[model samples]
Target: MSNTEIEDRQFITIAIKNGLVSKEKVDRAYILQRRIYTQAKVHKPICDILIQMGIITEAQKAQLNAARNVLMGKREEPADEVADDALPDINTARELELTISKDGLQAFIHPEHHQVQDVRIEDLRLFLNRRRIKFGVVDDGQIKSYLSQSPLPEKSFLIAVGQEPESPTPPELKFYFDTNPLRIGRVNEDGSIDWKDRGKLPQVNAGDLIAEIIPGNPGKPGKNVTGKTIVPPKLPKIRLKRGKGVDRSEDGHRFVARTGGMPQLIRKNRVQILSTLNIDGDIGLETGHVEFDGHIEVNGIVQAGYRVKGASIRAKELYNAEFEISGDIISLGGIYRAKIQSNGNLRASHIHTSDLTIFGDVVVEKEIFESTIETNGQLVIDNGTIISSKISAKKGIYANDIGTEASKKCDLDVGIDHRLEREVNLLKADIEKNGKLVQLRKADIEKARQRSDYLNTQLGEIAQEQDGYMVKQRDMDAKLSEAEADKDELQIAFYQKTIRELGEKRNEIDAIVEKYLEEDEGILANIPVYERDVAETEGHIEAAEQKIKALEIESEADPGHPEIKISGTIFNGTCVTSPKATLTTREDYTHTSMRETDVEDGVTTKKFRIKTTSL
Candidate 1:
């Protein structure tokens, strides 16, 4: 038999033998209790079952308890009483000898002075204070655990540790560079400073973030053994100092260049931006290599084997100097045996360079011989000879004569429309790419929004279902309370079963509500990310569209026209080029004009003839 069944049988036999209760009443109560336990898994005591079923009374249970106590030979518990006149005191149960290190960074104690049980936490604190070792504190539990170890402090054990003060961080300067400084001079492979460009000029653009003054960090205060605060020495002040052509930030943290110029750190303190570095004489050992931020003016020739860079240059003469220029160049004398690159227009009396690349228009006054020239704008040569040179221009090429009488070949390429065309095509391609991306981003945002709406609907439905379950549970509780107050056994049992069923329904609703809320939170979080993606994609699409429109306008404005007018005689063996065709001179002609014209065959043809009127 089960333990519960044996206990029930023993209790029934005892009650029947003592004549305290009848077998029929006990059996009825036991059957009811078993049915309740089997249905709901609620195990009620036998006395409570009997009382609920009106088969036993409280007075009878009390008499039975007295009899049971006598049979078991047990005594009852006694009542309590109060005491007066209690005194409070600190713990002084044990003695400990504490010692601090010379630097006040460490504190140790000897645990052999007392037994582990006799050690007191308050007495240890008092001893530490009296010895003026007040920086670090060891807890009571840690001390007790340490003392419990078999190894006593024959070697003193470290308990408390003090903190050290942090040193000050000095201020420094940070540079914002646009060009690689290492490329200016000879650079080493290993990661060490190259002093070749130590005094080299540093360049900056207008409104450029030149340098930032990193503020110094103050020292942190520390505590000594006696809890005395140790203050650190003050650090030197560093400022964001500026000179002419330089500006400082409002917060005094950054130094910015107000004008486009070369930066110079003078007197180890202030920064100044020199807009133009003037060289009165030739660019040689006297002027060093030029690397200025703004315009450069060389009154004399730039010698061979040197590099000169500037925003714009007005050199009287240039010879074999490597030049990287950003603005227009005006060379009054000539250029010979040099390599030059100009970001803006170029004007030179004569160019005999091996390589010349100009982004803007090119104007050569005299002869351009044995050179390769590439220009994005118009190529104009005034009464000059282009001998044995390759010249290409985006707009048109104009020269008085192309080749010499010695049959020196000169290649000329004009009517070049690819510059603006390429830009327009690239912009169109970017627009299409960004458009597709925007569509994809829009779709993603819509999908997320739809999912969010669905989740919100589910959340609302769950909330409604939960509200109904709550109402039913509350009603069941009220009915159970009413039944218990009336002392009606049948009503109480019926209401208890109803309440249990309502509780199970409420639990199901709670699980559903929790699931809906969690899914809703995830959807809400993803909504912002999708929204941001959509916005960024749209912005890219708009920017690409604007660029395409601007390039289209520029391409429309580019008209390819080639024109060459000679004031003097054009010799034989000279080659001339037009937008449509090339003409080779067979004989000398005076006041010659070379141009393109539409022929009757509907193809544009080149015409070279002696001019009667001014073009």
Candidate 2:
């Protein structure tokens, strides 16, 4: 190539490396220069084309030319020796394009299209230094080998590589128990769930290891192509807070269980062991019939077809399940078709077709439908209906409504002790039996009196016969002394013996009559005693009825009144009952209250009345 051509190429390479102009724009300028030269047989410099095309300004061109002169070691020649457009070249080294990556990690050198001597390693180093790539330069031997090729390689050559920054390792928490223990069961190949294999319950025994902390390292620094330090990010420290029933190791690196119970991870970093089994999800077949000795908390629903037993229970909803809880139960969502027996109070949103026997008070927010509920304390439905259900409360029952127009009949009984009522019924039966016994004793006294009268008449007949026999015996005795024949004397002796036997018979009949009189008196006396017993039992029954009435009156005046208070409509087919009376609705009544009150119908009687009032 001519000296002018080489100088122009050197200026283009320097302009591109300095970011004054892009390689693509310079290439286009070169194409235009070549086309003009071919069409008009004229030589146009690439620098002038680039300037005319607005790719580079004249000032930028001049600057690039100065830098090129310095890089190529071109000394200024005399004006007499060099033409105005021609450049004086003192060296014949090939020019190269240096490019550094955006990350400052790697650099490449592109060989230009020139047939000249190989580039010096010192010049290559100087070129990289100008681009701020002072680190990780290639060895001199490698650069010589790259330059000694038969034809200089046209592709880019990797001249330098920078060190990558090392990142710090993050702190790790390694739990012995499963962190996400409350999960659904595994799925089989046929898309069916293996409910028996519901994920592990993170249970731990006393002194068992629960978790451990793994320390992290602060990573080493790295150097970039500019020889600047790249510091790694700091490792985050993890802290574990010990909760109830949890013990930490002396070094604070290990967490252990202090009691035999389930382990739970709470608030992101706390490790706790709880006596209560905390189920984070639903109680379904996947959880497979929970039976816990302590309290149970279900975050989701207690699904259908599950049996759960616990000391206490708290759930979002209960659906077609059976629960036997010794303590109180709280269900946020409604209960449907569930059978629950709680010794303690029950609080729920609603109850539908469920059977509940609560010893303590029951509070339901919404409606209750087709359920059988018996409570010793009270049943309260604050804002909803008690439709198609049977409710019996010892203290009282309160609800917005008793039944619905389309629902089945609802039966409610309040202000009475069910046990005491049963006892009264038994006493009434006993009273009936006692009255029968009194009648039977009166009949026995009459029979005994008849027997005594018959015996006395028989004694009278025997005495009359004895008197005649005595007269005959006296006549026989007077004749015996005057008799001479043996036959007459024997006859008189026989008659006297007969008279004595008649007297003995009269005495026996008299003794039998006396015994009958005593037996009649005994029967009559027993009749009075039986009658007294019947009277005492009747008195007891009356007393019990009075006590029940008094209790009903007291319950009506109780703070939690033993009555049905309906804020909304109470429909037909609803019956409110007490121990003594019942009130069945015949039509819908709005904002009514039902309670047992005493009414005088000839005698004082307790009756159930529905009074319309604002609730």
Candidate 3:
């Protein structure tokens, strides 16, 4: 017997192996089939009897038929012929391929054939049975109709469905300011410091929770088409890289600030804490010397002879004290007679000291009187006056008015380069020299032409005189011959003397004409050389002028417009200096921006005009 026939002998065993029917159910169906034959005296297939007795559903029947067809290697009949469902005696089922969605919520089946034939319910059941897919909301008719369209055999149809996995959410970070170690400092709209909430020093106590880290959840597992489990992707751990004065929790999730001072989160991870040493009163013998790495805030005046150093130093009033800060220096009341140096911005109410040097910008609310101030950045006096002070800014200076008529010696300095202006002036001088040389060469050419013309005229006069002398000598010779022939001795002697004298005059005229001709020829020959010289000089002059024009354009293009604006009156004696120029006020100027205009000096370039204008 063929292998198909041999496998078909145990239909119940095949159904059980395909997971469509259990062994116990097959045993019960066999007993019922034997009782039907013995009591009703009628023989019938056990599978048909199991279906009629409601022991097996239509799906199980289809599974048995599909299993038998797979064993016999039978394929579905053509759609134009008899239907597979009508051929109950013969197995008209085909093998099918199964596919599952990514989520495993849907299962699809397709016939394993080049051209799809009509699909029966049995084919779908057998495909699902082999994969051990047990639970799904199956629609057999929809699957059958989908396969009837003669779709490409490799195309999958929705045959079974399953559940999907629920993924987990990641953790997030939360910051706490008031309750935590870091104190929040508020800034007003006018850029004034607010000390209402902040204490003497912004600090965080040790073991204080600075941030909260929420926990993440793991997702539930799902089932795939082959009854296999599907797992969700793993999530990354959430934690900040701790810096000084901060430490991570034991769970490697939460963060704690260990030190006290100003807390700053840098680079999205590191937490830096700076300590603060506050001074409630003035700087004296009681307070002693003060030096800190973080910040210093003095409530009262800073006495003289005290040297203070910190990152940032804030004083209510400073008088004759020396301060060195790497950061900012802010004086709320004023700075009077104090010598201060800072790396960052410096702000004061009124600066009347003679010694203040800052690396950053300096902003004063009131007048800066007789103060020797120097900063690498700008100097800004907001609606304030500047009196007889020597102020220098590497960038520029801006104030209401520099000095009054009484304090006319106030000096203000800005940043310009004098080298560029000097170079431009030198180019202009060279261009002028080249132009003059070109004109001189042209004049030389014209003078050569005039000299040539005069020589030609002299040569013509000499030629005319020589022709007259030759004719006179010839007439004298001819007359002497005639006299000798007539036997006149006295006439012959007179003619001979006249002819000799004419010959000498003609020789002198010929010598003069020859000298004039040589001079005229020389002038004519040198005219072309002189003309070439003039053309070359003209070209050199044009090139030099073009370079000079380019230099002028570069001088105009220089972007050095630094002005000191004053809303009030600027006194005489106030001197403002830029990189390339300096300006001293001659008269009292009112409500004007005192600026310097770039003026190229021939010998020494004056960069600033020291001019003022209302606009």
Candidate 4:
């Protein structure tokens, strides 16, 4: 073969190896060229044939030709020179068009054709001058560059832009305390809901700065492209008015609390502070829902379906009501079917069918029946009996009697902080969920592997079929060439038809092979992704387990040695659990005390055990 023929073959080889074109498409183009030559007695180049078939673009052909020339020790022409030679002659008759936005904020310049002559920087400047664009004009250097470009940009060029006027700042009132009251329960960090944690009221001390007036300024005006001044909107005026329990500073710009109480906004411009809220009668429809930032005192019972919140509370009785107090609570009468949460100590007469979460100590004068109480401090019931109650206390329990013979079982858990125990339970649940997610990810990976294997088998079968078709097509091509040389028209037609049929069959096999290969690749790719997800989920589970272990260690280090002490008869079915041990009474014990003690079971190791003794 000649050097030119070798170069052409090298170009085709390079294009195929670089993934610029497929080998199958190149082969088809060659067949088309051969057919044309056989019928018209005219030969066409492979590159030209490929381009005519829309398989390769002109730029792609140029790139391949350049590479082939470099490899064959021929000098390659510059890319810009080649591009210039390929471009058509410039259109000198077309004029430049200018467009401005109706708002006079933007201006753009357009050319009639891609290759236009006589486009100057002065022409663009004149267009802007005619449009009276006076502000935010684009740099002149950019306009010159746009005019010098070989092929003008298809989109319009931004020549000028205008500035917009700024809006004025309105006067605002800034309060030091919380203005929006929290009326609902709060959700804890561990996704647990605390129904009694209604938002705290805004409180202030005597002489504390409560509010201030912030003055606003008038914004500056702006000039547009047409030299028109744009004025800003007017600022609203605000005045501060002092109400009861509020004092103004000497400058009259700051407001301070005169007394220690809750600061409240009385109308839109008034500030008032309430020191205490007093209810002379029952808190029902007459009092509505009572919420205050200061102390609250109720003379009668809090009726059902009502909620009360205060920093500290004192009530005569609570009946099916809810109370959220940040400080201490004192109830003189019995609490029935009520829910109370207090951050400080609680002293009540009797608690029945109630749910209480107290952060401080609890003292009851009467009996506590069918109740759930969780306290971080000690529970004292010197003269009361606790019946069928579930109590969890971090400190200890001191009661007269627990669990009557006819009453339901009473469960008591002490020593460990209830908050830590709750967190551990939540972590355990998270670990379980993460474990299930890991299993699901593993299952998905297994399914993907199975699919990949099936697709591989299918692709292998398609490869064999494609090979068979190629062999038959080659044989038919040889027969067709022989008949053409012998001038046998009938034999030529038959062999040509046979070759085309074989080529069509090969194409069908190739399509099937491609589809199978794509499916196999997709499955293989996702297997690693699923594996990564499983690994991440497993990591999360491990972290949660480690956290639980740390929390357990902390819980086990209780220094209080909390226990249940009963001074009167303790009947059967009364169970008490400490951090280290648990004790359940099987028979009645009179005047007994229960505590945790370390005991040895015939070995060197010692474990905690609950011991009972008669008082």
Q: Which candidate should be chosen as best, given lDDT against the real structure? A: 4
Error of 2 at 467 (Å): 5.1
Model 4, 168-287: lDDT tens digits are: 887668999864333223446863335455456678899999999887777878766666777777776666788778999887779999988877653235677767788898999998
lDDT for predicted candidate 1 compared with the true structure: 0.66
> TM-score, each model?
0.41, 0.34, 0.36, 0.47
User: What are the runs in model 1 whose C-alpha is more than 4 Å off?
Assistant: 1-276, 281-293, 300-309, 316-326, 332-343, 349-360, 365-372, 382-390, 400-411, 417-419, 422-426, 471-560, 563-615
Provide the overall lDDT of each model, using Cα atoms, as 2-decimal numbers.
Answer: 0.66, 0.71, 0.67, 0.76
Index of the highest-TM-score prediction: 4
CA lDDT, candidate 4, residue 588: 89
- Candidate 4: 10-residue stretch with minimal lDDT: 85-94
Which residue runs does candidate 4 get wrong by more than 4 Å? Answer: 1-283, 286-301, 307-316, 322-333, 340-347, 357-360, 403-413, 416-423, 453-468, 471-475, 521-532, 557-562, 567-591, 600-609
**Model 4 — TM-score against the truth?**
0.47
Candidate 3 local lDDT, 1-615, one digit each (tens) = 645335435566665554556767777777886798799977677678668867666655664565466555775333343333322222222345656776677877666676756655574454455465555746666756675676445756666777667786777767654322111223468844343433333457777777767877767877666566777666545546666677788887777878766654432344555577788998877887788877677888788778888777777778877888866677776888888877666777788855887766687777898789887667877467888788877657777767766654787776542334455577667767767876776777688888878887777777787777777877887898899998798998899889888878877877777787788788888888877876876777677678767556544543344667766777876677775567677777877876666543444444336656784
TM-score of 3: 0.36
Candidates 3 and 4 compared by TM-score, better number: 4
lDDT of 1 by residue, 352-413 (tens): 85588776777777789999887777776745778788787766665676667684666666
CA RMSD (A), model 4: 26.3
Specify the poorest-scoring 10-residue window by lDDT in model 1. 82-91
Model 1 residue 377 CA deviation (Å) reads 3.9
